[model samples]
Target: MKTGNQDSSAVKAPDAARAAGTDYERIFHPRRVAVAGVSPGGGVGFGTRYLTSLQAIGFEGEILPVNPKGGEIAGLSIFKNVEDIPGELDLIVIAVAAEAVLPILEAGRKKGAAGAVIITSGFRELGTSEGIGREDEVRRIAASGIRVIGPNCFGIYCPKSGLTFFPNPDLSRESGPVAFLSQSGGLASDFMMTGMWMGLRFSKVVSFGNGADLREAELLRYLADDPETGVIAMYVEGVRDGSEFLDALKAAAAKKPVVILKGGLSSAGGRAVVSHTASLGGSRVIWESVLRQAGAVQVRDLQEMAQACLAFSLLPERVYRGLSFTGGGGALGIAACDAAETFGLEVPPLGTDARGRVEALLPKSGASGVNPVDVANPYAPPALLEKIFRAVAGDSRIDLQILIVLTHHFKGLAQDQGKTIEEVFPYRELADRMKAVAVETDKPVVFVLPNAKRGFPDMDVVEIHAKVREAFLERGLPVFDEIGDAMRAIGHVNRCYGKGETS
Candidate 1:
C-alpha cells in the first residue's frame, strides 16, 4: 500500500516549514476531501464507514476515495495513489494500517491539504517502541504543513460542513452554539447522541484520539475565539501539557462558559486512562484546584455536563440569585427551597402585594401564596399557571422562576374522559403560555416535568412526558426531570457569572 510520491524530499522538514497558522475554516468546512484506505468490497472499515457517513449527512463536498486496489466505493473511482488526485485537497481522512499512515499523511501534506483526521490505531496507546515511533512520525509530518486531529480516534463532526464521525449518520445537521472536545471517541459519539434530545446543539464536535498533533489545549484556544461557539464542553481523560492546558482553560473560561468533565480521577480509573489514551491522569486535588482557579465549571458526569451546557446555552449571562418556585404540592415546594438553599440560591417570600395577588389566583383551600406557591391541585389549567407565573415574576427580588408541572397526573383525567394522555393534557398550550409569561415578564422561566411512573405499564405516560419535554424545549425553556437537577444547573450558571456570593 504505497503511494506514488515516495520521495521523502518532496516535503520540507517539520521545523523549517511548520504551518504559520492553522486554517480552521478550511479544515472545518472543506470543499474537497479524500478518504484513504477504503476497500471497494465494502467491508466495515473505518474509511468506508466515514465516507458513507459523510454521504448520509449530505456532505456537499467532492469526496475522493483512494485504494491501492484501484476499485470503486459509493460510485466514486478509487485513486490508486494520493499523488494521482487532481489539484489541492482541503482535507484527508486517513484510515489505513499503522505502517502506511506516515506515507499517506506525508503525501497529503505534499498535496497541500489543510488537515487530516487519522482514524487508524496502533499508535502510542499500544505502549510499544514501534507504536510510539509511528506516532512521532505522524506528529513530524503534521508539523511540516498539514494539521492532524487523531492517529487512533474517531474524526471530526462539524454540522455546518456535514462532516460526521464514524457510525453516526443520523446526527443532527442543525448547527448550534455549543462546541465539545473529547479525547475518547466513544464518549464524543455518545455525547452527540445525548445532545440530540437534551436540546444541546453543537457547532463542532471533535474526537481527537491519541492527540499526537492537535490536542485539548490548542482546540480550547481555538474554540474560545470561535464566533460560532458560545458554550464549550470538554471530556478529558488526560491532557498532553498541564501548564498549557491550564492557561488555555483560564483564557477560554474568561471568554465563555467552559464546562469540563474530567475522567480518570480515581485510582482505578487512572490506570484505565493510561491504557485508553496513553496519557497521564493528573492528581485529583490538583485538578480540582486548577479547575476552580481557572473559573471553569467542573461537572461529575456526562449527564451533569449536558445539563450545565443546556443551562448555559439557554439562560441569560447573569447571576440568578433569587428564584420563585411554583408547584402542585407543598412537599415539592419545600424540596425546591431546600435544593435552592443548598446551591447558594434564595427562594425568598413574596412581597405583601405580590403574595396577595398570587394567593387570590390559587385555590381557596390547601393553597399557599408564599415563596414556593403550591396550587394543591395537579390538574391546574395552563391559563391559571400562566397567571401564577406572571404574578411570581412581578416580584422584585426574584431573578428567575421555576414552575413544576406534574404532567403524569393528567393520565387520570385522560382515563376519566376516555381519551389519551396526549389529548387530555394541554402541554402545547401550557408551553406556549409559559413562554409568553417569560417573554412578558422579562425573566427566564424553567420548567420541571417530573414523572414518578415510568414502568412498562405506563408507556403512555412516558411518551407524553417525552412529548411535553420536547414542547418545552422547543419554546427555549429548559426542562429537567427533577427539581434538584434544575437547581444544580442554575447553580452552575450563577457560579460562572456571579461574584463570590454564589461560589
Candidate 2:
C-alpha cells in the first residue's frame, strides 16, 4: 500500500508535486497569479464577472489584473500589461477574447509564468483550420513545459489555495477529502454549488477546457499528490491524451479513489461529446476497459458521483467485517438489497440467536427483527429503535450500521408565523433517538431521510432541510440524500479494512 512515496510524514508539501513531472500547486496554489484581461468598468465589462467572482470566493494570494485599457475592476487598480508586472508568476488564468489569448500568454511567458488556464473559447470548437492552427500555437507556447489548464475552460478552484477563476464556487467553510475535475466548465461550477447545497465538502474544483496544453491525465497525476484531496471525481466530454490519462489515473488510484462520469457512452452521447469537445468519440467498450484497468469507478449520474464521494470519504481507514442496514418499509429493504448486491456488500440474514436477541429487546410489532429488518409501525417508539440498534449492531460480525428514517411530517410540522414550537410534527425526537443509538452502537452510522429539503412546499418561513442537517451534525452523524450513499460508505469501509492491498 502507498508504494509511490515512502515518507508519509513529509506529505504536508511534497516537492515532486512542484516539478514538471508531477507538480500541480504551480497551477492551483500559485504564489503570484495574474488575471490577464480584467476590465476597466467597475462591474460592467465582460471580465467583471470573473474579477468579482474571484474576490467573492476569497482568493488569498495576490491577484494581478493585467489589462492594457484598465483602471479598476471592482475598485482594484490594474497594471497596463504583463510586461510591466514585476514578480514571479505562478499561474495565469486568461479571460480575454479568442484573439487576445496567445498574445497575453506570450507576455505571461516572458514574465516567468509557471502555468496558465485559458478561459477563452472559440478556438478548436469552431471546426476550422484557423482554430486548429490556434491550438497548435497554444501547444507551442506551452512547450516550455509550463502547465496549461485550458484554452476553453472555466479554470480551477482550490478552497485551501484561494485560487478561483470566473464562475467561482460558493465556497464552504467545510473542507473534506474530495477533489473534482471536469472537462465541462459549465458542469464543474454548477456541480460545485450543487454539492455544497447537498451538504458535501469540496477540496478542489477545476474545469480543464480544451486541454490544449495540459490534459486530464496530467491533472490526475497532479491531484494524486495533493494531501487535502482523498476522493477524486471527474466528468469528461472528450479526451486529449489517452496515454497520459491512463498513467495519471493509475497513479491516482494507487493513492486514493477516482470516480468518473463520462459524457460518451451511447451513440447519442458519443455524438454529444463530439459536438461538445470536438473529440473523436472512441469506442465505449474500450473506455470501460480502461476505466476498470485504472481502478476508477465510472458512476452513472451526478447524484451517483456525489454519493460515491460520501461513500469514499466516510469509509474507515481499515476494512469492515460486515454490514447492518435497517429500513422502515419492506420496499426500502428490497432497495437496500439491490444496493448491497451491486456494491458487493454482504447482506447476510441474522441468525436465530441474533434475531431472538433483537426481538427480545425491540417492541414486538415495531420491528421484524430480521436481516433487512422492516419495522412495521410508522410511529414506532424511538426507545424501541435505540434498543434494537443496541442489540443488532452490538453483534461482533457487523462493522457498519445504516439507519433509514423516512420523515416527511416535518414539513407538516410547520408552525404559523409567530406560533409556538410545541404545535409541530416532532421529528427531532426520532432524530435524537437515532443519534443516541448510533453513538451507543460505536459503529459508523449513516442516516438517510426521504423527501425533505430546506423549504418544503407548506412553509416559506422555516427551512426543514437546514434544521435537520444541523440536528444531524449536532448528533455526530451526517445526513445523506439517499441510501445509495449510505451503502457506498459501507462498501468503502469494507474495502479499506478487508484484505485488499494495492501494488
Candidate 3:
C-alpha cells in the first residue's frame, strides 16, 4: 500500500541524514520557524511553552503561530494554516494532535519546510493499533523529503541561535564545548540544567524522543562532525540499530570524548523503557562490551556523566598518577588514600626533601608530613600552606594535588579554638596561594570543600562556603564536595586520555 517515494525514503532515511548539505545546522539553526496549535490565551501546554521559550531565549526569527481558531498571541497575529503564512518557512513545529499532524506536515512540505519538530504525542508509545497506524502515517510523511525531529520530544535547544525548548532554563546563553543528546525529554532538561550548576556549559542539546526519523546514530554522527562541540554527552535507553550505532559511536569517539549513560540495563528498567520511548532495550553485557570496544566512557547515572563531561571539558589530556591533599585530620588523609587507591591512582609518599620542607611549615604537634599531607587544620597561615603545597607540587612523583578546605564546619572549629574566622579561614590568601602553586607546577590542582551548604538556616556558613568555592572555581580550579567524586572524575579522565595516547 506504500507509495514508491515513501518506500525509497524509508530505505535511505538513515543515509540521507548523513548526506551532504543536510546536517544538524539546518535543523537546529533554522532562520524562521512556525508553531502550530498555539492557543491565543497563553495557557499551560506544549504549544505555549515552545512559543514563550523562543521569545525568552531571544530567537531572532519570524515566529508564525498557526491555529484554526486563532486571532493573536502576545500581540502577534496567528495564521490559520501554514499555507496562509507569507514567504518561505524554514522550520515548522507541529504541536497539534496525532490525527492532525499528517495534514500539517503536508502543508509544511508544500510550503518548502526545511525541517519539522513534531511535539504531539499519542503515537506508537500508546501501545494500541490505532497509535501504531498513526506512527506509520508520521513515518510516511517524514519520508517525503522533510526531516522530522520527534513525535514526542522537547526538540532542539541551541543557545548560540537563541533557540530553547523550556522557559527559565537557568543557564547562560554562552555556549561551551559539550553537546548532549537524550531520548527522554524530562531527563535531558534535568541534566542540562544540573550540568550548568556544576559549571558545565553546552554547545547544543537535543531531546529527540522515539527518534522515529532522526535516531541516535544519526545524531552521534552529526555531533562528531560538529565544530562547536568538543565533547559529547549522551543518555540513551535503546538504539534501533546496534551495529550502525556502534559504528557511529566509534567514529565520534575518535574525534572527541564520548560519555554515555545507558539506561534499561535491567529487566524492570527495560520494560519501563519500552513504555517510555517504545525502544528495544539491549542486554547489559552486550552494551558494556560495545562501549568498551567503541572507546566511549560509560557512566552509571546522569550525575556521573555530568562529572565525566566536566573533566573532559576542563582538563587537558594528561595522565594523573600521584595524589596529594592538604587539610582535614589524619582520618581524612586515610580516606583520601583509600579513594585514590580504589580508583587505581597512586598515593606515593612525599620525598625526604619535600617532607622536610612541609615539616618546617606545619606545627610539630598536629600534622602528617607523609602523602595526603594533612596540615591538621585548613586555617593554617597562607604562606606556610603555600610552602607545603609548592613543595608537594614541586616533587616529581606527584601529578595532581587536592587542597581540602573544610568550609562550613571550619568556622565553628576556629571559634572553639578562641580564634576569629578570618584568622582561621583566610579564604582569599589561601586561594591566592593555591593559584600561585597551580601556575608554578605542571600538574593539575583542584579544591575539595566537603562541608558546602546552601539555603540553610545557617546563612552565615552558606555564604562563607559559597565565597570560598567561588574563589577556587574562578581560578579555573574544579571544586568537589567529596573526595570520591574528585578522584573518580580524575581516574576516568586519566584512563580516557591514557587510551588516546596508546590509540
Candidate 4:
C-alpha cells in the first residue's frame, strides 16, 4: 500500500494557524517526541505498554524521557527536564502532574522546542486554584509563539512517523485513511483499537485535551491539507471558532467526508459547543441547517463516527441502494428497516415472488420470506441460506443485501482452537458460498453476526467475518457491524453518489 505523502517542505500556514504554516507543520508532524513524567506500568495509566507500543511499531522519530524519578523507562535514560534532551526537539509531551507542567513549558520554550503535548489532567477540568494557575502558565508560554497541545489532555500521534501516545496496547501503527482529533484521550485510544478490526488505520490521531492553544478548528484545517489524511473524524468536546470551524468544514468536505461525533450536544453539544466555537445556532435549528448545507455526515458517538468514516474512506467507488438481509432477529430487521428509511431508502415489504424462492430454499419452516429474511433457525444449511436469498434476485427496491448470522455458540468456540471446524467462524466456506451468491447474482450483499456475547470464536474467526464484509465491500457491497450501519451506508450512498453498486 502507498503510504501518504510526508510533505516536510514548509508551506505557509493559513491565517487561521497564527499566520505561521511552519508552526502547524512542526506541531502536527513532529520528528522528535519527548515524554515528561513517563510511567513504566503496563496499564493505560502510564507505563512500559506505551513505550512497548511505540517500539513494537518501530517508530522512526526520536523519543526523550523527562522524569524527576530518574529511573530508566523502557530501558532508556529518563532526563529530569526537556532542555536536557540531546538535539532539537519537535514535540514535548507533558505527562507530569498538572501543577508541574508550567516549568516544563518554560524549559521547552527556552530550549526552542517546536510544540508541547500536556497530558496532565487536574488543571482546568478540576477547576481549582492550582488548575487555574497551571492554565495561566501554559497560556503564557504558548503566547511566546511555542505551540501547546493540552494542559488537561492525554497526547497526540503521527502514525506515519510513529509518534502516537494516544495509547494502543495492541494493534500495529500502519492501519487505514483516518486522521482523528479528539478532546478525550480514552476515546482516541479505544477508537483506534476497535477500528483495527476493520483495517481502520490512522494517518495521525490527536488528543487536544483541554485545547490550551491548538484548538479543534485549527487542527481540522491543518488536516484538510495533510496528504496522509483522507477522512477527518473529529470528536468535538468544544469548537473555539464557530465561523472558522464552518469555513474549515466546508473546505475539507469538498475533498473528504467530515464525520463529527459532537460531544456535549445534548445541551446542543454543551461544553464542546460553547468552548470550541463561541458560535451557537440554537442546537436544533442552527446545527441541522449547517449539516445539510455542508453535506457533512453527523454521527452519534465516537465508534459510530469512526466506523462510518472507515467505511467511507475505504469504499470502492459507488454506493448501492439495494439491501437484502438474512438475520435471525426481528428487532434488528425492524430497526434496520426503520433506520434505512430515514437514510432515504425504500424498504418495500418482501415480495410474494421472492417469498416463493425462500420457501423452496429451506422448507416453509426455515425462512422469514419478508424483508429481513430470517434464514438462521436451528435448521439452517448452506443450501437453505442460498435458496432464501435467491428470492430477492428480482427485487429492484435496494441494491444491497444483509445476512445476520445468529451463532450463539461463542463460549464453546473459546474452548476450541482458531481452526476449530465446529466453531461458528469455521463456517467460512458457507459464508463464502453466501458471498458467491451475491457475486453470481451481480448484487450487493452484507452480513450481520449477532450473539457477540455468546463468544462463538477467537478474534481470528472474527477477522474471518470482517474479511467477508471487506470482500463484499471490495466487490461493491456495503457491510456493517450492525444492520443499521449497513442500512445507513446504503442511504448515504444513494443520496450523495447515486444508486449504484459500491464496493
Best of the candidates, lDDT: 1
**Candidate 4 Cα deviation (angstroms), residue 499:** 13
Question: How do the residues 54-146 of candidate 1 rate in per-residue lDDT, one tens digit apiece?
Answer: 999999999999999988899899999999999999999999998999999999999889999999999999999999999999988887788
Which candidate has the top score in TM-score? 1
- TM per candidate comes to 0.92, 0.82, 0.87, 0.72
Tell me the spans in candidate 2 whose CA falls farther than 4 Å from its real position. 1-23, 267-282, 317-321, 327-331, 351-357, 374-384, 411-442, 452-456, 459-462, 473-478, 488-503
lDDT tens readout by residue for model 3, 406-431: 77776687679997555567788788
What overall lDDT goes with each candidate model?
0.89, 0.70, 0.80, 0.65
lDDT for 118 in candidate 1 is 95
Instruction: Kindly list the per-residue Cα lDDT of model 4 for residues 287-326, writing each as its tens digit.
Output: 6567656656777765677557656665544656556666
lDDT, candidate 2, 1-503, per-residue tens? 24344543254133234445534657667888888777776544435666677778777778888788858766677988888888778888788888888888888877877788888887887889988889889988877556677888888777777776466635664566789988888888777776765556778888877878666776687678888888899998667546546767878887888888888675433434535344544467668878878877777788777766766775446565466777667788788878887767766777777788777765566567777767765445667776767777767777777677655543333343444333353457767877777666677666776654435443432455456655765555666767777667556545533424541
Candidate 1: pairs in clash: none
Name the regions of candidate 1 deviating beyond 4 angstroms.
1-20, 267-282, 499-503
| Whole-model lDDT, model 3 | 0.80
- Clashing residue pairs found in predicted model 3: none
